[model samples]
Target: MNKIKNIHILILLIFLISIGQMSQTIYVPSIFNIAKELKVNMEEVQKLMSGYLLCYGISQLIYGPISDKVGRKPVILVGMMIFILSTFLILFANSLELMIILFSIQGLGTGVGGVMARTLPRDIFLNYENLKKANGFLNMGILVSPLIAPLIGGIISNLFEWRMCFVFLLIIGILISTTIFIFLPETCTKKQIKNSIFGYKILIYKKKFNYYLLILTSGLSGIVVFESNSGVLLSEMGFSNIEVSILFILPIPSIFFGSWYIGFSKKSFNYLMWKSVILCLLSGFFMWLPGWFKIMKIWTILIPASLFFFSAGMLFPLATTGAMIPCKGSAGTAGALLGGIQNIGSSFIAFISTFLPKNGQFSIGMITFIIGVIIFLCWWKLSRLEKI
Candidate 1:
């Protein structure tokens, strides 16, 4: 019975991770066509993305504490159900305003998955190495969805309509929720549950956890910056939706490779973290590289995208582990707080990146590089603390 219980929890974790991946991945390609259909400016549509993400980030604080009290299974299922309903609304959405509202609701669902998925493994797997391995799997699952989103979105939009993209999300959500309902067991113990909701405030006060949180949150800035800028920048450079889709896939292989590399290594130190930061700097350099020589081409943009994605893959797991390691008995709160910072910081990055000049590829590249460097400085500060 004990052995069976462990298997059930592991499967549940994987399923939740997949759902988390699906929620984020399903919307990327549809953004372009959806904006056209809604008859709103692209920036208005972009605000929808920002709204979902910010809400998703903020909801982590609420869900994390609630899950610790109510039990993981109930919180997760409620989140999944909400997500399914939101996706359905998005499928039939007619106006830009409606889509934005539904997307924010969708953010709530995705936010729950994000917090629970991270917290579940930390609850089940105690050691630093095992925890890192579980996180690697979670990250891998999230990355998998993006790998296919562009292609799937392209085909569906071409054959039927952009609305089908949400329809596809509905199908995926139903299947995932059903699997969780049947197979997933509650992982939290009664004693491990928080005595009060205010426990999260105590956890956040820890010095070590706060530094790591800064790194995890800042690292995500690059992703948001890129997402907010990519469609506009790529279109200006003569890439169509399909062409952008193909270019988007360029980074998946590199990301997968980075995750695999991190997983296989036994060492978990500041060195690997620095390597990720350096790669991010290089990615920024590559983004500006073509523009520097005045020879902007399709490959120039694609290559930098590939580099940035890979660097992100390398940094995320390490930073996550660093943040959670200090929490001791508060995995749920730690996961929630970490995820909150990531999404909130990302929302800010996406919003700020919008202010950059649209015509300059170098501007995007430089902005990406600056974000990477800021994360690196956070990493450096954390390293100094570890030494002391």
Candidate 2:
């Protein structure tokens, strides 16, 4: 609308969506190194992840509603600045105590860009099919970053130090901020939220919105429980950082399949959602198999995990697009609430998975199975309320 090319603005949005993951994934492989430098055990080292995720999830409650009021570009620009400043500060952390606090603050910045990034697609496309295609591209960016983040982090940490991950983030912040300032345009049609906290009631009160929110929560939680732990789990199985990084990339083919299915298939959103729910059940079963067998091959984890994430990745765009559909006035707030639920749900589940028995992978599988069943049952019951 601002006469900027849609392609340019869209590319910027996809990149911005990667912020939360890049913040954590790039440093995930370095958790052990961070523990060594900070003098802590692995269980305690995990709290850093929990702290960052908690802040990232909680801050989205504010980011979405505010974006609706202020317009999207300026909110993202300010967030980028906050992100850069916070990452720069982390470069100076000398103790685990200071690192935890800094990373928690970093999560605050993580909330800034994602709320608006998810909103802008609806702003631009304004049609369901086109939005799905746009969301496919958006989901691609989201999934691909995880594939690359750890690889990049592993290489950087191996060549330099874990702190270099922040250096990478600093450059990304500057670049994305510059892009938003120069090229990205405002996309909101109205500001309906009077108060951010109370605003969610308006959204949740919408028929089927809460169902979609619950679905988003369940979907992301499934993926994160495995993702947050996989790097460390693979490392414990005696693989090097590079090996874990490479194995993390195995899901790419399936994820691409899922994205492609959502973007190109003519199936109704209902059809897609049902397919995803079933996949979650199957994925959970397979995810549990690796730990059940007590086998340590990367393939044991990789094959089942790929199936689950493929469905998860496939569901990613659908869940987002569907959830925001009914809330026309508060797309920002809608996207924010959905994102917050997703991050908070996934973070909590992921953190809990790390603490579970049998070094967590077995519990990870059981939880994944249990959650998948719950999601299916919720959908089955809610589908009777009204068709999504």
Name the regions of candidate 1 deviating beyond 4 angstroms: 1-11, 193-195, 289-295
TM-score against truth, every candidate: 0.92, 0.93
Candidate 1, 165-229: lDDT as tens digits: 77888888899889888877778888784635587678667777787777777667766666667
TM accuracy, model 2: 0.93
In model 2, what lDDT does residue 162 have? Answer: 87
lDDT of 2 by residue, 1-388 (tens): 5334667777878778787678877877787888888888766677677777777877888888888787777777777777788889999989888887888888888787567657777677766777778788788787777667888898899899989988988898788778778876677655443345577888878756777778778877776766677877777877777777777777878888888888898887778878988998898887787777765566667777788878877788887777766566677788888888777887788778767763636777788888788778767765676454
Question: To one decimal, what is the Cα RMSD in angstroms of model 1 from the true structure?
Answer: 2.3
